[model samples]
Target: MSKFKYIVVALLLSACTSDDTDTLIENSNTLTNYLQDRSVENGAVIACAGNTEDDTVSVEIFFYPEEDATNYRLYETSSTDVDSNDFLNYNRIFLNDAPVFNGYLRKFTGEFTTERWFIVSFEKDNEIKLSNPIRLKNESQPTLFANAISINQQLSQMPLFNWNVNSEMNNAIFFQVLSTINNDLISGTYTYENQFQYYDTSNVILNITNGTPPDLVLGDDYKMTIMDVSVDNWINEIFVSQFTVE
Candidate 1:
């Protein structure tokens, strides 16, 4: 071949090879997955602030860039930093389809009926991103059995409401007092803390303040719901009954 033709053929081969190299570089898109947000709501609790027993649970998990994950699974365990191998002995469930900012919000259908941590398993980039555990506990059930609606001389005088705290409950628990009419909290509500089940089988008062009104309408029917919540939002058990303020 002529010298000019040989040079032209060599240039074409180099251009082809350069194109192949560019394609290879462009295809190297690997990412590490992480959890940007994780939360649990409306899980089964005996007493929530305004929740009922039959309420279903809502879960949320999100990551940046939005499309990195292809699978989201839920695992139940007593431990932390668990992986796929833990899924073997752990109670597991899959939230099928690609992931989105709003995660799978559904009922608690796992085999665990007592207490367990619900951990999110985000599968992306051929790796897993596990979330901080959202707990679900039923062992220490609190009861509002002692709080009864009273009609007396002083409406401003709140009752030292009675309750039962479970042994499995956290040392610090949240207590909510609601004055309700027709099953709705009327006027305002109050919340208090019960530490370490210290006051189990006893009563306490939610002191009404400016945030919560001290006035109660006389001759009007009202009910008091004493609800206790665990520290991790895992337990809520409410006791409710009707009484008129005379």
Candidate 2:
């Protein structure tokens, strides 16, 4: 072969190899095989906050670790939900270190004005434990539930949370979250009452929940958030109140 032709062939071969390498790298990072390899289940508690001023959404994940799980990985997808057919498209985002209260918690912030979904998983003894799909949607508008909310901080240690729920929300599930001022989830659960007492279990429904009960710090501020969630995981209304521990 002529010297010029030999050089041209060498350049083409290099280009082909580079393209192949890029494809492999992208495939390796995808969640194509995660769903098939993991045992999917529920129990991850997700709280979403939408900033109307910034047109963004913030999601927080707080859950209890499976026995012997050393770490947890969080996956994200723009899909509305991660059904069996859509699970393979999820992309892992956060890899948490050590399965402690603080370690099992993660916060995700994005410029999302629409809804998104996520899945969290952990591995122990080669067995992967995956959480049921959690959804995050931006709700920038106020609702009736927001207008009818009130908190009684006179009994500071365990503030009484009260809200008015009309007949329309009779079947809706209510969620209460207690978090530190810094946004760390302390305790959260699904409840069925219009009035809930912090750190108390009177109104709790299915204690299959997340976060540790707060060890209130004197003079520190904490937040209590109440959400009315629809069956399909859409947050219909949300109200947040901050109170100082006496």
Candidate 3:
């Protein structure tokens, strides 16, 4: 009777242990499936110009879980290996306050001025699964002017030159304007403007009003180049299409 009782107790303990192991295995499978189904991609582009800052840009991480993910932790790295087991060294973002969802968006805000690349991974059940890597390139430089050209009509009151501002550029410090006649006549200095577009006819130029410089020499061809100058003097050059003055 005593032997039978001991045997029964051993079997009960064994059964309970087996049940616990099975529960762990099921949880692992659920987490794995969730990670496999999720995806990550590049987020929004944020730009900061000069010394000012804006928080409009956000870095987003998207995810969907199959089951109720408790104590979910996010890890990030710059490395490419998606199978690495150890990611504790990488930066982490906790999802404790995040709402349950078939999909969730994690947004990060701060200075992203310099170019950077990062990889993100999810963690649960002592398992680490990596998402697709994201690349964030910083576009803080002033944009190049486009389609600059010299208007025909040399004897005109003023040399007519036009250009398009770089679409990516914002908050320009000034514009550096350069003019050349017959591709040999170089201007002395640059011009400044807070605006994206500019036109030179008469009042802007001394010769246009006084008639001393004559705006331009009649019948002579001219080429003009315009550049957007930043505080750092990062100049984006735009050369005009050549045209002859009438």
> Which candidate number would show the highest TM-score if scored against the true structure?
2
Residue-wise C-alpha lDDT for candidate 2, range 107-199, written one tens digit per residue? 344445465676666667765655555555554332323535576767767677787664444225676767787667787666766678777
Across 1-246, the per-residue lDDT of candidate 3 in tens digits comes to: 121111111101122255545654554433222333333211111111111122313333323332333333444433434432222223453433232111222323334444333334444444443432233322543233355453434435354444455543532323223334433433422333322112342223111111222255566665554444332223333344555555
What tens-digit string does per-residue lDDT give for candidate 1 at 81-159?
3441222224554444332112212123333334455544545555455443344543334222344433233423343
How well does candidate 2 score on lDDT at residue 75? 72
- Looking at model 3, which ten-residue stretch has the lowest summed lDDT? 4-13
lDDT of 1 at 36: 14
Please give the RMSD of candidate 2 to the true structure: 14.6
Candidate 1 Cα deviation (angstroms), residue 228: 2.0
Question: Which is the better candidate, 1 or 2, if ranked by lDDT?
Answer: 2
Pull out the clashing pairs in model 1. 47-236, 47-237, 171-196
RMSD in angstroms between candidate 1 and the native structure over all alpha carbons: 19.4
**What RMSD does each model have against the real structure?**
19.4, 14.6, 24.0
| lDDT of candidate 1 at residue 25, scale 0 to 100 | 50
TM-score of 1: 0.38
| Global lDDT of model 1 | 0.37
